[model samples]
Target: MSGIDNLPPLREVIATHDLAAKKSLGQNFLLDLNLTAKIARLAGDLSQSDVLEIGPGPGGLTRGLLAEGARRVLAIEKDPRCVPALAEIADAYPGQLQIINGDALDVNPLEHLTSPIKIAANLPYNVGTELLVRWLTPPAWPPFWESLTLMFQREVAQRIVAQPGGKAYGRLALLAQWRTDPRIVMELPPEAFSPPPKVSSAVVHLSALPAPRYPANPATLNRVVAAAFNQRRKMLRSALKSLDPAIEDHLHAAGIKPTERAEQVHLEAFCALARSLDS
Candidate 1:
């Protein structure tokens, strides 16, 4: 266990600071430096990129980012107790680790960094999916961040990269795959974290595309996908009945078979339906 700066073991820091992972915050601190460094590598070369991290519980991943020579790291952590713990790292790094003791969802992180940003975090479980969706759905092409390397529960990781015909495929897969290439790079057992979570976790790295893989109205595409997946067991014609009077026409126009179910439809086909709906 190589220390980032002889900063003492994470277990000692947590114990000394009286910092216990708060259940309310969905906090599960990862203590292993080996694993955290691996996650940092998964984000690619951070030396040229500024990084934004959410919920840096105990500063393990934050240390990883800094040690890997990220240009700088801005960590937003909601837990007040972890502020000083992270501050210690900030001092050790001297101008590299910038911390915000605020809710990540409420704060606009893009305001802080001048350079291209890469986000890396072992996200708190409660808001992980919501935050990811927010990051992926900006109206303009090429979002503020260059890439996102985030950790989520294993199930959620699968959902982000899952393809059609897989049960894990749904809104997340469509949303992530539409504008970015997301893949699960590493999987961790429950024991990997302090106060181990009940389920396994995985790290997903998403590289942004200059534009969406296909053309479609974002609003229309989201609505169409939501409607179809909400009634996933039903055929497209039946599930999309609420979309418009010409649901079948839209399907046919998009070259999609009306008999297909949501789980069977691909991202390209969904984009087609969204485009057809706009027509």
Candidate 2:
């Protein structure tokens, strides 16, 4: 039995259900209950917040969240094979768990979640970044979730919390840093999973700020950042030339150098550039 609950251990659950990891769906199950609980703790004070988890294979992390005292958990799993295992978890936790068998991208979690929400997941590799970008770029400030504790490939984690002038600094770094306080809180080796991934993994914790760190139109910033990094190696002047005829002037007005590459510009400068372009 998993110590966290009276339910069968994840390995047994997997065996009974024949839930082998599927590569096409980006499954890499974490069978270690202790490790999953540790990851859950990183979310901080789940007692009052509802948690939305993505890709909870065999309910390892789902169990962790519930055992860690999350008020409620809404887990979205794409693979139907794992639902019965998750159903077992629901029976153990009673009213605290809800399972949805569907794609996370297509599901509107807000429908199931209540206020003061936190999102924690051992996300599937293929769709992790896309989900994160959607969460980071919601139409309004102070998004649905109060915080996000998510696992990503270590390289992607670096990009999320990356600073200016680094290889990892790009649109993701800007988008995440602009309106939230994001940090890499934990790292795990490939062997942590059942069918280990080739690369290492890290967990990122992002707390939403009451407002953006700097004021810029979201659409404009996204457009400019996308343009700047789409040709990251090019100078801002050249990379952003398609943005406006006076792109260099806008860069100068934003206190950025025309010669600076996208990686060389910080979040504040990017916001400023977006504002300048919007003017």
Candidate 3:
């Protein structure tokens, strides 16, 4: 039995169920209970929060969330083969665990979760970035979840928390840093998973700010950031000229140099540009 609970160890569980990590699904099952519990702890105190977990293959992290005392856990697994294994976890936790066999991208989790929600997952590789972008760019401020504790390939994690003037600093850095306080909280080698991904992974903890770091319309900010980074090598004036006839004037108004490339500009300056464009 896994030390964290009465449930069978993940390897045994996977073997019994004939559950192999499928490359198409981007499944790399994290088999260590201790590591899973540590990841759950990184989400902070879950005693009062309902957690929404995506792609919970073999229920390893689900058990950790439960063993760590989450008030409720809503797990969405796309693979039907893993549902029965998760069902066993639900049986052990009684009412605390709810398993939904559906695609996380299509399913609206707000329906199953309560207020003061937190999202914790070893997210599927294929859909991780898309899901994160959707969460970060919601129409409203102070989104459905209070925080996000998620695992991503190290490169992607770096992009999420990257600073200005780095190769990793681009649209993702601006987007995540604009609305949330994101940091890399842990790193794992490829061997940490069952089949093991080619790239190393890291866990990012993002606490949603009460409001954006600076004021800019979300749609405008996204558009401006996307445009700037799409041709990052070109000077802002040249690259953004298509955006407006007087793009240089807007850049000057936002206190940005017209000749600067996208990577050289910081988040605040980008927000200022968005505001200038909105005006």
Candidate 2 lDDT over 30-121, as tens digits, reads 99999999999999999999999999999999999999999999999999999998998999888999999999999999999899899999
Error of 3 at 195 (Å): 0.5
Per-residue alpha-carbon lDDT of candidate 1 for residues 1-279, written as tens digits (9 for 90 to 100):
355556878898899899999999999999988788889889999988999999998898988888899999999999999999999999989989899999998999878886789999999999999999999998787999999999999999999999899899999999999999999999999999889999999999999999999999999999999999999999999999999989999999988999999999989999999998998
What shift in Å separates residue 265 of candidate 2 from its native position after superposition?
0.6
RMSD of each: 1.0, 0.8, 0.6
- Ordering by TM-score: 3, 2, 1
lDDT top scorer? 3
lDDT tens digits, residue span 1-279, model 3: 779999999999999999999999999999999999999999999999999999999998999999999999999999999999999999999999999999998999999999899999999999999999999988888999999999999999999999989899999899899999999999999999989899999999999999999999888888888899999999999889888899999999999999999999999999999999999
Superposed by TM-score, candidate 1 places the C-alpha of residue 118 at a distance from the truth, in angstroms, of 0.3
- Cα-lDDT of candidate 3: 0.95
Off by over 4 Å in 3: none
Off by over 4 Å in 2: none
TM-score of 1: 0.98
Positional deviation of residue 14's Cα in model 2 after best superposition, in angstroms: 0.7
Clash number for model 3? 0
